[model samples]
Target: MSRPPTVWLTRASMLLVLLAIMLVSGPARAHEFRPALLRLTELADASGQGGGRFDLRLVAPALSTAGAIGEGDLTPIVPAHCELGQLRLDCGSQGLIGELGVAGLDRHPVDVIVELRFVDGTQVTAVLGPDQPTMTLDGTSDGTSGGADNDGVFADYVALGIEHILLGPDHLLFVFGLVLLVRAAGRNTRTLLWTVTAFTLAHSITLAAATLELVHVPGPPVEAGIALSILLLARELACGQTDETARDSPLLSVNESTKVSASGREALARAENSWSWRYPWVVAFGFGLLHGFGFAGALSEVGLPQGQIPLALLGFNVGVELGQLGVVALLLVLLAGGRALAGAVGLSEKTARLATRAPIWAMGGLAFAWTLDRVLGFWG
Candidate 1:
């Protein structure tokens, strides 16, 4: 009663194509939490308070001239009416007379990149998001300036890093793929731990290098590559392939014990265990390098001050690791909880096992959509 192998392959291919089209042709919701970039210029003006002058530009897709921005919106750098034009929000005057953060940010959550430049050539840059909406602005010539405090350097950047990873769906998807890869290795906690740690270390290396200007790669390509990595994992997951074979993966025994014949299991094991296949951590380390570049590109744009680079980098990397751990832990809990419920309902173990393939397909579909969108974006 089983479908022919060729028929199954054709059907799967058609479904993949359909999924790609359905996801890419529609209005994309890829960036659900894009942050606002705030560029503040401080210069001395004859009509300025204490001879200080400032002008602000806030850029975000949410800022547009078409709609009405109520008082509950993001607060600009200075006290003045905001006018939105073409994804740009502007406020302040030549004379920065009003007090800093007069109204603070609105009730809602907003992410802002605060950049400050003084006449004395000092630069202070920091990320202001929903977690932090306001900061003091001082524009004194020949005066010391700082954006992030030394005390909070580790904590703040850590929080920012965590926030960025959580907000980024692509990154989350990549991590989810990793979970599938590591956990599938007979749920060997040691393998999973090492793979995750290796990934963290690899990305941390490139993230630091890129942020410090030791390395530079376009953000778009890196993002596209991350999506591609997820797709690769999906393929592996679907094929039941890994760095092991029938003789290697502990799962091979489990697969044999199932209703599946030993011959079929052997085929699955040998094909997956082929020398051409990559180890889980090896794949993670490789793709993680690209993902790190993506992270660095974002962090740079988010305005980490040159002086506080080290602390910010550490904190952000830590945050990313924490987020990754959180996700893996959550997945484990859900899987355990689901299995318990399934058993309670008298579901056969073999039937329940079928659900394991869901993540592979879901990841594949989403990754394909993102890949198509990003590739098209290069020209669009």
Candidate 2:
């Protein structure tokens, strides 16, 4: 037997309310991997003995006065051979070379981007993590940075990109909404491919453009727009109700050998008439541009490696695509398993339909909450 409509609505409402509360109350930037910046510039000495003033500044984004981001002090570890002065390290004739590390990083696990500029115009940039707190400053002028080589830059960015997508609940929800939209429209695999491809291409363009400074948009508005996009998709999914009474419609004669139900024909006609159903790729592509801006905002937080922007950009974009596809695959598998289990348990069609629609409601509720919070954040 099917569940009462009132019960289904009540359960869905409760779930939506809970999700909204959690999303609205939680720290917005809690999961974001905002990197701290560490810059060191070697000062010129009259004797050219490689001893000069060192400007050590650790800049990291923070929200509250609690946690490692707020309380930890970052001090640069200087070479033992050099005399550590108040602002400069004196290495009388050593040329400012040796092991370099940042103190106070052990207290936190944030990635710190290190930039070393020598008097001879040699510049080296590397990413320092808690696991590997120290780097050997070889004091070389070669293109390779002493700590992070080209390969390391690529890999670090790839990992960062993957981590960003996985940690971003909003982006995942948008993709999930896309999947629901495709399934509701009864789209084939080819259509799904087009939809995903369009989204990827559109976002990649904007991400590159925004990162390269070719395009600039306010981050808060972009965030709100991304949430709005998900809400729009949810609306479309909710509107796609199948009609089972139009049995004799000629729309079913496309295949005479196969049985065509009234509901199937009605669905096809609805799909044909609906712009979202017929051209989902267009919708995805348009919204993807807005989402790309959101991605650029995150990328901007973790400054790009100097002289390797292209490589880092490529790696990050590739990582994002990998993470996105993984989410889609995992969701597909979970949905399949859920359907199989429902069938095994002999669930009523109405109950199953309610379960399917619950996620859509959750997505809409969460997206709405996120949009409202981000928009109000503009004032804050």
User: Per-prediction TM-score, please?
Assistant: 0.73, 0.80
Quick one: best TM-score, which candidate? 2
Worst 10 residues of 2 by lDDT: 245-254
Please give the clash total of every predicted structure, in order: 1, 0
In model 1, state the lDDT of residue 311: 77
Instruction: Summing lDDT over every window of 10 consecutive residues in candidate 1, give the lowest-scoring window.
Output: 243-252
After superposition, which runs of candidate 2 have C-alpha atoms over 4 Å from their true positions? 1-13, 16-20, 23-26, 29-31, 45-52, 63-68, 73-78, 81-96, 102-107, 140-147, 241-272
lDDT of each residue in 59-108, candidate 2, tens digit only: 66452123546545667777778777555666656655677777767776
- Clash list (residue pairs), candidate 2: none
Per-residue lDDT over 1-380 for candidate 1, one digit per residue giving the tens place of the 0 to 100 score: 99855455445655775776576434433333444567656645565433344455665534222333354365554534433344343334433322233133455455565555555566555666554566654434322234345555577677766777777777787777777666655547677777777788998999889877888888777767877877877787667642222322211234343455566576567545842134788877888887788777666655565566787788878988898888778876776677667657764333344344445666788788878877777887
Query: How far off is residue 235 in model 2, in Å?
Result: 1.4
TM-score of 2: 0.80
CA lDDT, candidate 1, residue 336: 67
Best by lDDT: 2
Candidate 2, residue 245: how far the Cα is off, in Å: 11
